[model samples]
Target: MTNPTALQLIARSNRLGADSRNTNYAGGNTSAKGSETDPVTGEPVELLWVKGSGGDLGTLTESGLAVLRLDRVRALPEVYPGVEREDEMVAAFDYCLHGKGGAAPSIDTAMHALVDAAHVDHLHPDSGIAFATAADGEQLTKDAFGGRVVWVPWRRPGFQLGLDIAAVKRDNPGAIGAILGGHGITAWGDTSEEAEANSLWIIETAAAHLAEHGHPEPFGSVIDGYEALPEDARRAKAAALAPVLRGLASTDHPVVGHFTDSDVVLDFVARAEHPRLAELGTSCPDHFLRTKVKPLVLDLPANASAEDSIARLRELHEAYRADYTAYYERGAAAARARGEEPPAMRGADPAIVLIPGVGMFSYGADKQTARVAGEFYVNAINVMRGAEAVSSYAPIDEAEKFRIEYWALEEAKLQRRPARKPLATRVALVTGAASGIGLATAKRLAAEGACVVIADLDLERAAAAAAEIGSSDVAVGVQANVTDEAAVQAAVDAALLAFGGLDLVVNNAGLSLSKSLLETTVADWDLQHNVMAKGSFLVSKAAAKVMIDQGLGGDIVYISSKNSVFAGPNNIAYSATKADQAHQVRLLAAELGEHGIKVNGINPDGVVRGSGIFAGGWGAKRAAVYGVPEEKLGEYYAQRTLLKREVLPENVANAVFVLCASDLDHTTGLHIPVDAGVAAAFLR
Candidate 1:
C-alpha cells in the first residue's frame, strides 16, 4: 500500500517546481514526515520522505522519493564528525533507510532529516534568493518578514549547515522559515498544505518588499552605443557569429549551442553595469553550477559587423583562458596549503557568452543542457535585479565559487553520468532529408548520439521528419534547395547556430529521369546535374569552411548510385550526375585530407520504397524500361542482384553510417556499394 503522505509530498513538490518563481529547475527539495507500519517489526515508525538526488521537483514521482526512518535520521548527529568532514554524513544517509529505501539521498537530506516540521521545502526561488544574497541579507530577512522568517549565515551545504538551520528553528519558537545568507530560502509547516503555503508566503513577501522599495532602473541606463540592433539584424549577426563562438567554447571538447534573444537578456546586456555585474557572478549554488562563475561578455555593441566581432572575440577568448587558468591555480594552491589535492581542471572555456545588443549564447554537451544553462543565467539576472534594488548585489567570493565548481562530490557526480554514444557531440547535416535514404540516415545518426539537421526543399515535411527523429535540441528541420547557393549556405549557418558546429555532411538530394540520350531534354540534364552535382558542391564548400575554422576534422558522405559505374540504358542525365558525385568524393577526399576531413561515397542500385524520387514517377519509368509492373520494381530489382535482396532506404542509411563510423577513420575516398551483390557496380 502506498503511503498517502508520500503522495501528498510529490503533489506539493510538483506544484512548487512548476512555478519558475518558486525554484529553478532541479534546484530544490521537499519532504514529508509520517508514521508507517514497519514490515519487520509490525509496529508504526516515523519516516521521512524527501526528494532524492538530481531530480526535478516538477517531475517528482513515487520512485524519485527517498524514504528513511525519522528516528534513525535524527540520531545521525551523534556520529557526525564535525564540519570538516561533513560530506561523510551524506554516505551515512544510506544506513538510516527504511526497507529498500528509494532513490539515492541528496546532500539536502540532512536538512530535511534534522528539521522538526512535519513538512519542509528548500527552494532556490528568485524572489527569496534575492534577499538571501543581498549585501545586508540578514537585516533584509528581518525587515521582509518581521522575524517570521529567521536568517542563517552562509555555510556550504553539509551536515553542519543542516544542524545550523535546525538550531535556528529550535531557538526561534514562532519562526515559519529561514533564509540562508548567500544561498536560498527554506520553509516548513505542520502539514503539506501549510508547508507549501509558507514557502509561497516567504517568496511573495520578499518579492513584494523589493518591488515596493526598489529603484525603477536597478540595472542602470542603457549605454549610448549598446542599444539592441533591429530584430532581423540582431538574429543575422547572432547566426554569423555562432560558429566562431562555438569554436572558442570547444577549446577543450565539442559542445552544443543555444541562442536566446528574450527581452530580459536584451535589456540586461545593453545596460552600463552589465559587465560589472556579470563579473561579480551568480550567488546561489544552483545558478553558478549551470551558468558558471561568470559569463564571457563580448566587449562590442550588437551592431558590430561579424568580421570585426569575430576578430576581437578571438583576442578576448585567449585572455579569458589565461585568466581561468590563473583562477584554477589560486584554488589549487589554497587546497595544497590545507594538505588536500585539488581536482583536475575540467575546462577553461566559458559556458555562457553575453553579447551586447544581440543576446546570450550558452554551450553544453547536448541541447537540453545548453538551454538549461541559459535559463539558469536568466534566473541569475533576476536575482541580481532584485538584490540591487533592495541593497548591493553580492555573490559568494571567488575562492568559494572555485571550491564548489571543483568539489570532489561534483566530480563524482560527473563520473556517475552514463557513457557517451559513438557519435556523441557530433553534428550532422543531411540534404533531402524529408524522405528516403536522407531521412533514414538522419534518424540513424541521431540514434547514435549525433545532433542532426534535416534539410530539404519542403519546410513542412522537413520539420515533420525532424520532429519524428527527436526534440528541437537534438534535430532541426531546415528549408533548403540544394541548387540554390544562398539556400545551401543558410542551411549550413542554421546547423552552426543550432548545434555549435558541423562535423558530418550527407549529399543525398537528387532527382532521376529515365531517358535515353536521344529522349533526354536539355532541361532534364540541367536539373539532375544542378541538384546532385552542383548542390553537393555548394553544401560541401559551406560546411568545409566551418569545419576548417573549428579545427576539428569532419566527414562528407556522397550518396551516389550504381548507375555511376554500370552502363544502365535510358538513364543518361541521372547516370552522368551520379558519376559526377562519385568522382567529387575522391577528389575532395585527397584535397581535404591535409585538414583531417574525410570524404566518402555510397552506391546503391534501386531504392524504390520511401524514396522521394521513385515515388514521384521514377519507379514507373524504371519499371516500364525493365518490362515489369511499377509495384513490382523492388521485387524485380532484388531478383536481378547477386544477393537476391531488395535495397531499402535503411540499407543505404546503414552504408552511410559505416563510412562515417569512427572505425573507418582511415578509410576515406572509398565507395561502398549498397547494391547487394551487383558485380557490375563494384568499385574497381
Candidate 2:
C-alpha cells in the first residue's frame, strides 16, 4: 500500500520548488513523519521520509527519499560525540533504515528528525535569506514576524545545528519557524498543508516588509562607464570574451560554461556597490558551493574593444589564480592549527566571472551545473538587494566558508561520483550536421561524452538534429553558411559560449556535381570551390584562433572524397574541390603542428545510404554517367571495390572518431579511406 503522507510531502515539495522565489535548484529538503507498518515486526513504527542527498525537490520521486525509523534518528543525540565530530552522525543514519533504505541520507537528516513536527520545510527562498543574512537579522526577524518566528545565530550545519533548532522550537511554543543567521529559514507545522502555508507566509511577509519600508534602489546608483551596452553590442562582446574566460577557468581542468545577460545580472553589475558586495561573497552554503566564495570581476568598460578586453582579462586571471591559491593556504593553515587535517586543494580557478556590461559567465564540470551556478548567483544578487534595502548584507566569515567548502563529508561525496566518460571534457563542432555524415559524426561524438555543436545552413533542421542527439547540455544547433566568414566565426563563438572552447572540428559541408569539363559552367565550379574548399579553410582559420587563444591543442578533420585521388569521369568540379581539401589537411597539419593541433582527412566513396549529397540528385547524375539506374548505383559501386561492401555515412563517421581518438595521439596529417577497398584512391 502507498503511503499517503509521503505522497502529500512530495506534492508539497514540488509545488514549493517549482518557483525559484521559493528555493533554488536542489537547494532545499522536505520531510513527513508518520506511522508505517514494519515488515519485520508487523507493527506500526514512526518513520521519516525526506528528500535524499543530491536530489532536486522539483523532480523528486519515492526513490529520491530517504526512509528511516523516526525514533532511531531522534535518538542520535544520545551517542552524538560533539559538534567537532558531528559528521560521524551521517554514517550512523544507515543503521536507522526502515527497510532497504530508499536513498542515501543527506547531512540534514538530523534537522528533519529532531524537529518536533509532523511536517517540516527547510528552504533557501531569496526573500527569507535576505533577512537571514542581513547585518541586523535578529532584530529584523523580531520586527517582521514578531513572536511567530525565532532567530538562530550562524552555526555550520551538523547534528549540533539540528539540536540548536530543536531547542529553539521547544522554547517558542507559538513560533511557526526560525530564520538561521547567515543561511535561510526553517518552517514546520502539524500537517503538510500547515507547514507549506507557514513557509509561504514567512517568505511573503519578508518581501512585503521590504517593499513597504526598504529603499527603492538597494544596489546604489549606476556607475560611470559601467552602464549596459546596447543589446546587440553587449551580446557580441559576450561572444568574444567567453572563450578567453573559459580558457582561464579551465586552467586546472576542462569545464563546461554558461552565459547570462538577464536584467538582474546587468543591473547589479552596473551598480557602484557591485565590486564590494561580490567580494563579500554569498551567504547560504548552497549558494557558495556552486558559485565559489566569490567571482572574478572584469574591470573593463562596456564600450571597450574585444582586443583590449582580452588582454586585460589575461592579466586579471593570473592574479585571480594567485589569490585563490593564497586563500586555500590560509584555510589549510587554520585547520592544521586546530589539529585537523584539511582536504586537499580542489582548484585555483574562479567558477564565476562578472563583466560590468556583458553580464555573467559561470563554469562547472557540465552544462547543467554551470547553468545552475549562474542561477544561484542570481539568487545571491536578489538576497544582496533585499538585505541592503532593509539593513546591510552580511555573509558568513571567511574561515567558516572555508571549513564548509573543504569538509571531509563534502570530499567523500565528490569521491563517490561516477567516473567520467572517455571524451567527457572534450567539445566538438560539426558543420552541415543537419543530415548524413555530419549528423552521424556529431551523434557519435556526443555518445562518447563530447559536447557537440550542430552547424548547418538551415536553422530548423540543425536544431532538430541537435535535439535528436540529446539535451541542450549535450548538443546545440546553429545556422551558419560556411562561405560567410562572419557566420563561421559566430558558430565558433556559439561553441565557446555553449560548452567552453572547442577541441575538435569536423568540416563536412559540401555539394557534388557530376559534370564533364565541357558541360560544367563557371558558376558550378565557383560554387563547389566556395563550399568544399573555401568553406573548410574559413572554418579552420576561425577555429584555429580560438584554439591558439585557449593554449589547448585541437583536432581538425576535413571530409574529403575518394575522387580526390581517383580519376572518376564526369565529376570534374567536385573532384577538384575535394583535391583542394585533401591538400588542406597536409598544409594545416604542417602549420599547426607546433601548437599541438592535429589535422586529418577522411576519404569516402559513394555513400548512398543517408547521404545528403546523393539525395540531392548526385546519385542520379552519377548513375546516368555510369549507364545504370539510380537504385543500382550503390550495388554497382560495391561490386567494383575489393571488399565488395557499400560505403555508408556511419563508416565515414567511424573513421573520423578513429583519427581523433587518443590512441592516435602521436599521429598527424593522415587521411584514412572509408571506401571499403578503392585501389585507385588508396594513399601511396
**What is the C-alpha lDDT profile of model 1 across 1-684, one tens digit per residue?**
789999999999999999999998899999999999988889999999999989999999999999999999999999998887888888899999989999989889989989889999999999998998889999988887987999999888878988998998899979999999888999999999999999999999998999999988899999987988898788878878887888899899888888888898999999988899998998898888888888899999877889999999999889889988999999999978877787899899998998888889998888888889999999999999999988989998988888888887787788888899888888999999999999999999998889999999999999999999989988999999999999998899888778777899999999999998999999999999999999999999998888887777899999999999999889999999999999999999999999889999999999999999999999999999999999999999999999999999999988888888889999889989999889887778
- Distance (Å) between predicted and true CA of 654, model 2? 2.6
lDDT of each: 0.91, 0.91
Give candidate 2's error at residue 50 in angstroms: 1.0
Residues 120-183 of candidate 2 have per-residue lDDT tens digits of 9999999999999999999999999999999999999878888998999999999999999988
Question: Candidate 1, which ten residues in sequence have the lowest lDDT sum?
Answer: 403-412
- Which residue pairs show backbone clashes in model 1? none
Candidate 1 residues lying further than 4 Å off, grouped into runs, are none
Give the C-alpha lDDT of model 1. 0.91
Clashing pairs in 2: none
